[model samples]
Target: MTAEKTDTLIVGGGQAGIAMSEHLTDMGIPHLVLERNRIAERWRSERWDSLVANGPAWHDRFPGLEFDDVAPETFPPKERMAQYFEDYAKMIKAPVRTNVEVKSVQRCAGRPGFIAKTSQGEIEAQRVVAATGPFQVPAFPNIVPEESSITQIHSSNYKNPDQLAEGAVLVVGGGASGSQIAEELMRAGRKVYLSIGEHYRPPRSYRDRDYVWWLGVLGKWDEIKTQAKKKHVAFAVSGYDGGKTIDFRNMGHQGVTVLGITQSYKDGVLSFANDLAENIKEGDIAYLDVLREADAYVERNGIDLPPEPEAWDIQPDPSCVTDPILELDLKEAQVGTIIWATGFKFDFSWLDVDAFDDKGMPFHKRGISAETGVYFLGLPELTNRASSFIYGSWYDAKYIATHIGVQRNYVAYQKEK
Candidate 1:
């Protein structure tokens, strides 16, 4: 069968793909967007029942669009966010084809363009953008013993506390998802054990400004990934509970047993590292540093903001440091569930191109891949710290679209010559 043709073919109909389609449309570029499922499928299906966007509504949307009737300072629920994206796509009139799974994207034989094989059929395109984003695979650690009796579920499949077997829960990972899930389980009157890891602890709000706002004003959001000095895999913040600081210490006080980094499960017992105190101290330092930076920024810019609250400077006592539960027998603790809040991994195996690094990530300089005419969008640190955030989509899409336009124009000039 003859393949359908287009100037550009965008893979994945999530926020990233839709953003790319919108920009390409604005530039009068003829393109097609292919989605395996409905648009914003992950936001609708993969997220937990109580999940809300990590960023506030004001800072989480594309340019010139505000979340419908939602407070700027408040975070939108997962359902609301999914609807917002669907509405945004409709408003832009993006040429998106849902339920069309792209099988592979490869360079055409003796040709400059690419041929994309999809479930529906085949398509030839001058350019391609892999906007599949990062949350492709649920990353569960190898440490968990498969022979163990306890039931396990990754954060991606986790829906609600009622779905789990009746017993204590061991939530592995100190990231945002894990921390939130652990807290939710504890509040549900379940004995919860949270394994802490190297994660950032930033206040949800400082001086009446959201944490994301500070990151933007401080210019931290625009910092390139490679040049970044320190990076934390996850931030501890809860948007579901009206944007609250996720303090493991407070969680401990609320009856959740917070442990150190998970080591391994041996003979039905789980082992943990002895760095609970150190983790707390590190998080404390980061918390103070952010507040201090905010203070300095206010003074330097001569901006009127609220003074730092006295509670902000207070550090909790590291009670979990001295007598940390380094080991626990799954049966003895009545732990019936092991929830892996270990985050997600990216999969680019569908793209048969010589543009990946050792980790299978595309070698791209801010979405422009080493393989010409192949671009990546919505990956972590693709351009800046904000590259994966909802607000970052607009800027990254613009950059990718501009490159496509320039390349197309240059090719046309070469043909004329």
Candidate 2:
């Protein structure tokens, strides 16, 4: 079959892909955006029923688009966020082809281009931009109990309280997702057990302003570099209930059992690390580091911001912690659900080129891939710290589109059917 050709081909029709397509359109460069399922499929299905953005709606936007005169300061629900992308696609007439799942991508053997094998057919292009998104696949520990009859589900699959069994839940990892899901379970009157780890505790509101506002004013996200993005990005404090800095404090008062990180599991017995106190200290240290940076910024800029109220109100409480290092038998403990909020891992195995670095993730100098005529979008700190977020992706998309538009050597690859 004759492959349809375009100047640029963008894979995945989420925020990143949409941003890329919009910028390319502005440059008068014909392009196509291919999505595996529907546009923003992850937000539509992968997220929980009551999920909300960590930041305010005002900052979540692509180029040539901003949140309308509605709920700018408030957080948007998952469904509304998904609708915004779909609506934006229609507003800008983005060339998005839904349900075009890409099987593999390879460089043309004899030309300077790529051939993307999709569910429909192959599509050839002079330049290929991968907007495959930040969250690709869920990552879980290899030591989880496989023989046990207990229900095991990743946070991505979790919808609401009714989806799980009527018993205690063992939530692993204490990052943003883990914390949020654990709280949701608790609100539903389920016994919740949350693992403690080195979590960043930036306040959602500081000095009568939202953390997102301060972050933008101080350029907090921009300080992170590309190298650090590949290593381990620090977890943000959950922004579920507005922008509160939630720790393990007072959780016990609310019927929460806080434990140390999960170490190993066997025969329905889960062993936890004896480092809960140390983990709490680690989180505190990270929190203080961020405050120091914020203070320095205020001093440097001579901004007369008022003192942060109740910033240090959350203190380490010994009562909130149970046995830090205990082995709990799932059946005996009445725990029927194990939710792993351990984050995600990207899969770039189908790319038949040297697009990955030492970590098996796509490596590029900004969005330009190692292979010529190939690009990567929607990655954290691809160029700046904001590159991974909704607003930040637009900058990366613009940069990639501008560079590709000026490249005169992008020759289309084609063969006679």
Best by lDDT: 1
List per-prediction Cα lDDT, in the order shown.
0.88, 0.81
Model 2 / residue 275 / CA error / Å: 1.6
| Alpha-carbon runs more than 4 Å astray in model 2 | 224-230, 299-304, 320-323, 409-417
lDDT of 2 at 87: 90
Q: Which lDDT tens digits does candidate 2 get at residues 1-417?
A: 899888789998999999998888888998999998999999999988888877778776665667674477788888888888999999889999998888888888887678989899998888888899789999888767566788999889999999898899999878778888888899989998887666666666666667777778766777643444224634757658765676676665677788887888887788888877776777777667667767787789898889874675656565646445467888888999999888888887667777888888787899898888889999877987678889889888999988987784334345669
**Predicted structure 2: lDDT:** 0.81
Off by over 4 Å in 1: 224-227, 414-417
Global CA lDDT computed for model 1: 0.88
TM-score of 2: 0.92
